[model samples]
Target: MARTGWLRWGSLGVAVLVLVVFLVAQRQSVDVSYGQSPSSSGTVEEGSAGELSDATVPSVEEMSALVKASPVVRLPGSTAYWDEARVNAVIGDAHILVAPPGLDEAERGRVRDVEEAGIRVIGTEVTGGAYQATADTLPDWRAQFATGDVTNLLVTLAAGIAKRPTPPDVDGFRWREPTAAEVEPVAADLRASGLHVAAGATLAKVPDSAKTAFPDGALYVALPRQPYGEPVPNFGPALVKLFPDKPIVVLYGEWIEYHGPREADFASVAAASFYGQAADRISRYAYPQGNVLHAYLNRVTDVRYAGLFDRPLPYVPLDPLRVALPALPWLFAACAAVFLALSATSLRRKAFTTTGTPARLAGLTALAIEVSGLSHDPSVVRGIAKLTAASEALAENLPDQHVRGLLDGASRDLDEVARALGRNDYLSDVYLRGRVA
Candidate 1:
C-alpha cells in the first residue's frame, strides 16, 4: 500500500526479468565447435598414374649425397636450371655452382602430359626455360666457375655448360657464400687448376626470384635459393596427387650456417636461423597465403596438399593430455549447470518445511493484496482473491499434518487482519477478541 512497498515489488520484478534475459543470452552465445575450417582438398585433383621413368630419377644414394652436400636442395630432382651467366651474376666473383641431376625428358614431359589426362598443375612455366636448362647442364661435376674477362665469360660458358658428358663418382661441391677475404684466392685456385670460374665482380648481381616469394626478407628453412631462377615446382605436386591416399612426411632442412660444424654439436649460432625466425613467425599462426601446409613447407606448393595426411595437420591425437585439457572448461560449465539445478531444488524443499510453508503462504496472500491495488477493475481483484484461496487449499493438502495445522491457523486470522486494515484501525474489536483468547 505504501510507496516503499510498491518500489520494492517493482524492483524485484525487473531484477528477475533481467536475470532471465541474461541467462538466455549467455546460453545462446556459447560455441563448442572449432571455428577452424575442416581440411579439404582445395582445387587439387586426385588421379591415377603408372610409374613413368626411373632412369633420371635420383637413387636413394644420390639423394643422400645431395641432401648432405648442398646448403639448399631443390625438390623433385635437386638441380638448378641456371645457365653459367645467371650463376655468375648471382654468386658474384667467388662461387662453385654444383650442377646436380635434374628431371629427365620423361619427367619433364609428364608435367605437360598430366594436364591432358585431366590433372590440374600450377606454377610450371609452360615453355623451355627450366626443362631445357636441365638437359643442357652437366650433372655431378664441378661446374665452371667465373673465368678470364668478366664480360666475355658469360657468353663463352653459356654454350659450353651443357657440352660435358661425364658423370663423376664423387659428390658435387656444395655451394656457399664466400666471405670477401676468401673470394679472390678461391677464384685464382679454380682458374689455375684449369676450371672455368665465375669472377667476384658479379656477387648478387642477379636478384633471386625465391627472395621475391618472401618480400619481408624473412628466410624459410625449406625454401632453397638457386642461381638460375626459381625451380619448376610442378614435379613435386604432380607426384603427390598420384598417391592422394598415402601419407607423405615432409622434412624441412635448415641453412648450413645455422648449425654447428658437426651434427652432434647441433647448436644454432644465428638468431635469424630457421628455429629463430621461421618457427617464430609460424608459431604466431602466420601462414604464407593463409595456407597451413605452405607454412609447414615454408614454401607454397603447386597444389593444395590437403587430405594427404590421414590425421589433421599439426596432428595431436597421440597426446591425450593435450586433447583433454582444452575440453576441461566446457566440461566444467556442464557440471556447473547440473550443480545449480540440484541446489535450487534442494533450497525449494527446505523453504517449504512445516513452519516455512505457512509463512510462505501468508507472504503470498500479502503479495496478492499488493498486486490487487495496481488494477482498478473489480475482476482483477477477484482473480487475485481466487489465486490466494487456491494456494491455501493446496498447502492444506500437503502430506505433513503439522504444516496443514499451521496453514489453517494463518488462514483463519487472514480475514480479521484484512477487516482491521479496511477499517483503518490498529486495534479493532476482532483483534482484541483474538488477543484475549
Candidate 2:
C-alpha cells in the first residue's frame, strides 16, 4: 500500500510537470529589434507631416554632437531648460518637436527646412510668438505629438538669445527671467488647442487662477530651492495628480550636478512613483544643462535605437539541456513498474495457522505450568510436595467424607509423579509423561 501511494503521487507530479512544459512552449516568445534615424541640423517643424525618412536620420552619436555644440539655454530664474540641451544630445532628433505658440510663417518655414533635412517635426498651436510672450508651451507641444503625427519629440529653445545671467562655466549662453504671469495664458491657449496640461513642482505653486486655466497635463519646470541640493519630496506625486493622463518633464536646478546620488535617488523615487501610476505617460527627469548633460547625451546616443531599449530580446538560455529533457510520462511509467514488481513478491510469501483441540489444550497447559513455576525442573518436586500438604489442610476444614477422598487422590498423584521423575532423572521426559497422562 505504501509503495502504491508513492507511485501514485510520483505519477501525479510528473503529469503536472509535463503540463507546465507544454504551456510554457505554447506561450508566445518575446523578441526585440532596435533601429535609429539620422537627425537633421536645425529645428523641428510643428504640425502635420509624414513619417520621417529612415535614410536621413542621424545615429545617436550625431545627435549628441549637436547638443554638445550648443549652449545651455533656459528661461530666466527657471532650471527647466537646464538639461534641455543634454536631453537633446541623447534623444537626438527623435524627440517629438513642438513650435512655440503663434509661430509666424517665416519661422515655421525655417523649421520646415530643418525637417526636410531629416529632423523629425511636430507642430503645436503654441508658436514662437507665444513662447516669446510667455515661456509655458509644453502642453501644446504634447498635444501636437499626441495627435499621432509624431511619436517621439524633444523640447528645445528658440533661436533668440536669453536675457538672464549665465553660469560661469557656460559660454555664449544666458538665462532670461520667465514671465510667470504669462504661463497661465499660454497654458490656457494650449488647453484650448486640445493639449493635455499637467503641473510640476514649479507649476503646482502657480496661482490657482493659472492652475484652473491649464487644468491637467501641464509640464511644470522647477529649479531646486537650494543650490546644489536635492529636490523636495512629494514633487512627483503632485505632478502625477495634475497630469494623470499625460507625461510631465521635471527640470532640476542649475546645481543639479552637485546633488550627486541624491539627485538620482530623487529621480528614481519620482520615476517609480510616476511610472507605477502611469507608465504609458511620457515622464522625464532632467538636470540643468552642463557637463552632466553632455554625459547623459553621450550615453543615450551610444544606444542602438532600434527599439532595443524599448523592446529587449530574451537572454541567452543557461540550461538548454534541462529544457530539452524527455517527458515526465516515461519517468512515471518506470516508477509504476518498480512498484508493481515489489507488490507481487510480497503477496507470494508463505502463510501460517494453528488447528486441532489437542494442540489448543497443550498450549493452554504450557501457559499454566509456566505461570505456576512448576515448569522449573529443579523446583517441581518441592512445589508438588507443598501442594499435597495444602490439600490435606483444606480437607480437614471440609466435611469428613469429602476431605478424606480429596486428600487420598492428591497423595496418589504426587507419589506417582515423584517416582517417575526419580527413575528418569530428566525434566523433559517427566513433563512429557505427565502431560500424556
Best by lDDT: 2
Give candidate 1 regions above 4 Å deviation: 31-217, 221-437
Taking the tens digit of each residue's C-alpha lDDT, what string does model 2 give over 274-298? Answer: 2233212112112222222222222
lDDT of 1: 0.30
| lDDT, candidates in the order shown | 0.30, 0.32
Off by over 4 Å in 2: 1-175, 181-184, 191-437
Give each model's clash number.
Answer: 11, 36
Q: Against the correct fold, how does model 2 do in TM-score?
A: 0.20
